[model samples]
Target: YLNSFVDNIDEMKEKERYLMEELKNQENNFLGIKSICSNKVDRVEEISRLKIEMNRLGIFLKNNQGLNDFSIDDIQNKIKEIEEYYVSDEEINNLQNKINEFKSKIAYPIIEGVFGILEENFSIIDKKYEEAIYSSMGSRSKFLVVKNEKIGNELLSSNNSSISIIPLNKIKPKIVPGDILRNVRQLGGIPITELINFDEEVSKAMEFVFNGYFLFENKENARKACYDYKVIGVTLDGTLYDPKGTLCGGKIICKNIIFRRKDLLELEQSFKEKKENKRIYEKEKYNLNELKSKICNLREIKKAKNDIQIIENSIKFLNKLIESKVDYSSELSSLRQNIVKKIREKEEFLRRKNVLETEIFELKNKIKSKKEDEKNILKKILQLEGFRRQSEIKISKKSIGEREEESLELKRKHLLQNILKSKSKISKLRELLKEFKSGKNENSKSHLPVQFQEISDVLDDFKLSSNIFNVDLKIFDVKKEDELKKELFSVRKEIEMSKNIKK
Candidate 1:
C-alpha cells in the first residue's frame, strides 16, 4: 500500500511539471498576441503576426485534427461579412472565438495534465483504414502512452484505477515477416499501420499495437486475408475476421475519438484559405507613419478593433484555465503527501502486529509441550510403583524357612539401605534399568550409579536363591504369630526406604 502511495506522489510531480510548462506556454501566447498591437497599431505587423499564428496553428492541427464538418465558407464568409461592419459586434466576436476554439478545445485538457494522454488518439487513422485500425488497436487506442515503465506504473497507482498506460521503454514494435507482408499486399491488403501517420518518437508504441493487422478493401478479401494468410484484418465496413474463425465487429462510437483523413485535409485547406485571405490583406499595407498620419478606413479600423477584443477575451479565458489547473495540481500534491504519510504509519503498525503474533504462537506451543511432559512423568511413576509391588510378592512367595529367609532379607536390606536413601541414585537406577530393558543404547548399563549397581548384583543373587528355596519349602516348618510381627516390621522398613527415594 505504501509503495502504491509513493507511486502516486511521483505521478503527481509529473502532472505538476506538465501543468507548469503549459501555464508558461499559454502565458507566452497571451503576451505574444498582446505585443502584436500597441497604442498606435502597425497594420503590417498585425498581418505578420496573424500569418505566424496561422502557420503555428497549421502544425498543431497535424497531430490534433480539426473538425471536418466545419466548412471553409464559415471563415470566408466571416471575412467578407467583416467588410460590411453591418454584422453585430456580438457576431464578429463569436466568429473570432470560433477561430480560437479549435485550439481552445485541445489545449486546456493537456494543460491540466492530470492523466496521461495517448500519443496517437486514432487521429492517425484515415477513412479507408478506420475498421482495420479499430480492430487492430481496439480499446488500446485509448491507452495512454508514457516515457517509461516507471511513469506508466506511477500514473496507474493514482486514485483513478480505471485507466492504463503503455510505457515506450517497455514496448517493442511487432515484427512482421517480409514474405507475409508481400503475401498480404498481393492479396489486396495493406498493413493498417502504413496508412496511419504517427511521430517517430511514438513509432514503437504505434507499431507495437497496430502493425500485426492488415486492411482489406472488403469483407470477402478480409476473410481470405485471415484464412489464407493466417493473419487478422478488417473490412472498410468494420467487419473483423481472424484466422481462428473469429468474426466480431460493430460500429464503435468514434466521434471526437477518431479523425478521418479528410478531417486533416480540411484543416490544411483552412490554413490555405486563411493564407490567401492574409495575402489579399497584405497588398493593402501602407507606410506605418503615413498610415498613422491619415485616418484608415472605418472597416479596417473595425477589423483591428475587433481583433484586439478577441485577443483580450482569449487572455481572460486562458487565465481561468491556468487557475483551474494550478488549483487542482496543488490539491493533488497535498493529497499525495498525506497518503504517503498514512501508508508509512500503517506499514509500521503491520510490522509490530506480526511480531506480537509470532510471540503468541511460540508461547502456545511451549505450554502444550510442557503439558505432554507432565502426563508422561505421572505415567512413569505409576509404572514404577506397580513394578515394586510385583517384586515384593515374588520374593515373599519363595520364602519358606524363617531363619534362612530372615538372614537373606537382612543382607539385602543392608546393601539397598544406602542406595534407597539417595533419591538421585534411585532416579538413575530407574533410568538405567528402563534404558537397559529397552535396549536403548550400549552406554545405559555402563553409566549406572555405583550404589545402584551393588543393589542390582544383590537382586540377581536373590533370584538364584529363590529357585533353591522352592525345593526346600515343602519340608520347612511354618512359624505363625512371631513370623507375622517380623514380616510387618520388614514391610515398614521397606515403606520408609521408599519414602526416602521419593524425596
Candidate 2:
C-alpha cells in the first residue's frame, strides 16, 4: 500500500517542475510586455540583470526572456551594435591599458584574447588562417590549429616539436569554454593526441543554444574509455547540431537513454500485442476477488439453512413426542377400562365366596352340636347298663335278661340317626370350600383369571403400533428445497461473473 504512495512522489516532483517552469515563463512574458509598453530600450542592461536575478524563477521563464521586449529585427540589430561597441577605437583606446592589465591577471584570456595568443606565438599559423587553411583556436589550453597540411609539415621541420600538430577536421565542433584541442608528443618522437577534451565543449555549446543537453556516440568506440560517457556534438554558434544521422529519421537517445520519438513509437507498438494477455490476467484477478466474496456470502446462507434445518428437526422431534404421549394416554385409558372390568368381576366373585363361607360356618357349628348330643347319649347308656347289672344281681337271671333286651334296641336306633347327621355336615363343608377356592381364581367374568403380565404385554404392543403410525408433516421437502436453492445461487454467481468480464 505504501509503495503506491511513495511512487507517486517522483511523479509529483516532475509535474511540479513543469508547472513551476510554466508559471515562470508567464511572469517573464508579462515583464517583457511591460518593458515594451514603457518604450525603454536603454534599460536593456537592467533587463539582462533581471534574467540572472530570476534564475531561481526557473527554465521556462529564462527561455521566454525576462523584462526584455524586442522584435526579431530588434534582437539582430542590438547584437550587431554590441559587437561594434567593443571594436570602436574610442572605447578600445580608453580600455587598452586595462586590457593589458587584465591579460596579466588571467593565465589564459577570454575568447577575445585567443587571437592575441596566436599572433604572438604563431605567425605562420595566422597565414594559414587568412588563407582559410587554419583558424586560431580559442580554448583555456594554449594550442594552435594549422589548417594547411604544408604548415603542419613546416612546424614539424622547425623542430619546435613541443607544439603538437594535427589535421583541423579531426576536432569536434562544440568546444566548451575551457576545454582544449591539441596534438602533444611523447617518447616516440611522433604526435599522438589530435583531440583533447573536445567532448565537454560540445556539451556546453548544446546547452547554450538548444536550451537542452545531448549525448553522443561513435556507437562502437564508446564501449571503452569512460564507458558510460557518450559523445556530444554542437555548432560554432552554440546551437546543438544533431548527430549526423539522427535528424534524418535515424535512431537517437534521450536523457533517460531511451530512444526518442520514432523508436518509442515502435516500442509502444510492440506492447500492443500483449494487451490481450494483460486483459486476461486482469479478468482472472477480478474473478478471484468476486469468488471470494461469493464464498463468504455462501457461508452465511449455509449457516441460515442449517439453522432452519435444526429448527425443523427439533419441531419434528417435538411432534413425535406429542404423538407418543397421546398414544400412551390412549393405552392408559384402555388399561383403565380393563382394570375396571376386572374389579367388577372380582367384586362378584367376592360376593359368591362370602355366601359359601357363611355355609361353611353353619356346617362347622352343626357338626359341633351333633358331637355334643352323642356324648350325652353315651353317658345315659352307661348309667342304664350299671343299673341293669345291680338289678340282675338281686333278682336273679330273669330280671337281668329283660333289661338288656330293651337297652340294645334304643342304642341301635340312636347310632343310625347320629351317623346320618354327621355325614350331611361334612359333605356341606367340602362343597363350600370348593366354591371359595374357585372364587379366589376367577377374573373379568371368566371361569379362569386373567394374568397381570398379559395385560402389560397388550398395552406395549398397542403403543408400538401407534408410534409407528405417527408422522411429523412440517419438513416434507426441506432437503430438496435446500439443494435447489444452492444450485440456483451457484448459477447466478456464474452469470454475474460472466457479465463482469464482458464489462
Candidate 3:
C-alpha cells in the first residue's frame, strides 16, 4: 500500500508537470488571441465608421442625382441654337466670341451719324398726294441732313461711313417762277411749294429733295404741265415727266430707310436674348457637370463596398475566433484547479507517511529496549536455574517505503510543492480572470479604446471625409469647375491613403 501510494504521488507529480506545461501553453495562446482581438477591434471600428460615412456619401450622391439641370452636350446644343441666328457657326467655334460678334452682322442704324433724316422734316399739306413726292424722291428721301458742314465732314471721315449726309449750311434751295407754278396749278398740279411742310430752319434740305417735283392728277396732266412749264411734274402714280422729256415711273419704296432703325433695334433685342439664354445654359451646365462628378464619386464608393464587406467579414470571423477560445481558457483553468487539488492530496498523503515513519522509529527503539530487558531477565533466570537462553527478532520494511530520505527532507519537498502550487494557481487565476473579463467586455463591442491615438486619428479622417461629402457645392460656378475638379482629386487621394493605413 505504501509503495502504491508513493507511485500514485509520482504519477500525480508527472501529471502536474504536464498540466503546468499545458497551462503555460494555454496562457500563451490566450494572450495571443487576446492581443489579436484588441488590435483588430480598433481596425474593425475604424472600418465600421468608414462604412457609415461611405453609406452617407452614397445617399447624398443618390439624392443629388435627382434631375440634373442640363448635360454639357445639351448645354452646347442649346447655346448653338440660341446664337445660330446671330453668330455663325464658324464664329461660335471660338469660345471667347460673344453676342457682340452678332452686332457686326446687322446693318448700322442711319440715325447714328445724322442729326435727322430729310423726310422727318417734311409733311405735305395734302396727305392724299404724299406718295407723289416720296416716290419721285425715291432713295434721295433718305439722305441724312447734318447740323453743319463740320458734322458732315466728321461723318464722311468715319471709317464705317456709307450713308450720304447733306449739310444744312452747304445746301442750295431752288426757287420756282410764279407763272410756272400758276400754269401747273391750272393743269391740275398741286404745287410742290404748297405741299412742302418745311420749317425755315430745315427748308433748304427739304427743298433739295422735293423742290423740283409737282403733283398733277394723272400721267397725262403731269406730261402736259412738264411740257408747257418746262419743269418736272409728278402724278400720284409716281410717274415723273421731266422737262427734258424723260419719263420715270412704276417704282416705289416710301418707308425703306425708316425700317432700318426698326430692323436694327429688333436685332439688338434678339442678340441680348441670345446672350441671356447662353448665360442661363452655361450656369445650368456647370451645375449638371458638378452633379455628374458627385455621382462619379458615388460610383467609387459603391465600388469600394466589396472591400468594406470583406473587412466586416474578417471582423466577424475574429470575434467568433475569440469566442471559440473561451473553452480553451476554461480547460486551462480546470487543469490548474485539478493541479491544486492533487497538490493538496499529495500533501495529506505525505503528512500521513511522515507520521507513520516517526511512529515506526519509536516502536523500533522500544522493541530494542524490551529485547535488552528480556535478555537480562532471562539471564538472571538462567543463572538461577543453571540454564542458558538466546532470542532473535527481525523487523522489515518494503523497498519503496524504506526511509532512505530523511523526514525533514520530505517535509521540505512537500512545503516547497505547496508554496509553488499555491502561488502559481493564484497568479494564473488572476491572469485568467483578467483575460475573461477583457474578452467578455470586448465581445459585445461596447468597449471604446480611447487610449489609442491611431483610432482618434482615424475618426478625424472619417469626419473630414464626411465633411467633404456634405460640403455645399452651389457656390462654385462654371468658371470654377477646374478648381472643383482639383479638390475632388485631392479628396480621392486622401481616401486612398486612409485605405492603405487600414490595410
1-503 per-residue lDDT for model 3 (tens digits): 45554555566566656656765665665554445545546645655666676676657556656434435555455545544434443533442243344335423334543545566666667666667877777777667777688877776777385777788887887777888877777878776667766667776787776666788887788888888878788888777889897878885656532433334455566656656666666656655566566556545655556656655665566666545645645655665676566556656656665665666667678889999999999989878665322221112344334564344355445434543443443344334334434665443222222212333343354345335433233422333435434544453454444346435
Checking candidate 3 for backbone clashes, the offending pairs are none
**Model 2, span 14-92: residue lDDT tens:** 5546545655555544443344323334344444444453443344334434323534454445444433322334543
lDDT preference between candidates 1 and 3, better one: 3
**What TM-score would each prediction reach against the true structure?**
0.31, 0.15, 0.29
Q: Which numbered prediction scores highest in lDDT against the true structure? A: 3
Per-residue lDDT over 268-351 for candidate 1, one digit per residue giving the tens place of the 0 to 100 score: 565556555555444433332233322233334344556655655654544554444345445445555555555555455456
User: Which ranges of candidate 3 are over 4 A from the true structure?
Assistant: 1-113, 124-127, 159-161, 256-503
Say which candidate scores most in TM-score: 1
* Model 1 lDDT at residue 315: 49
Error of 3 at 170 (Å): 1.3
List runs of model 2 lying over 4 Å from the truth.
Answer: 1-333, 397-503
TM-score of candidate 1 on Cα atoms, chains taken together: 0.31
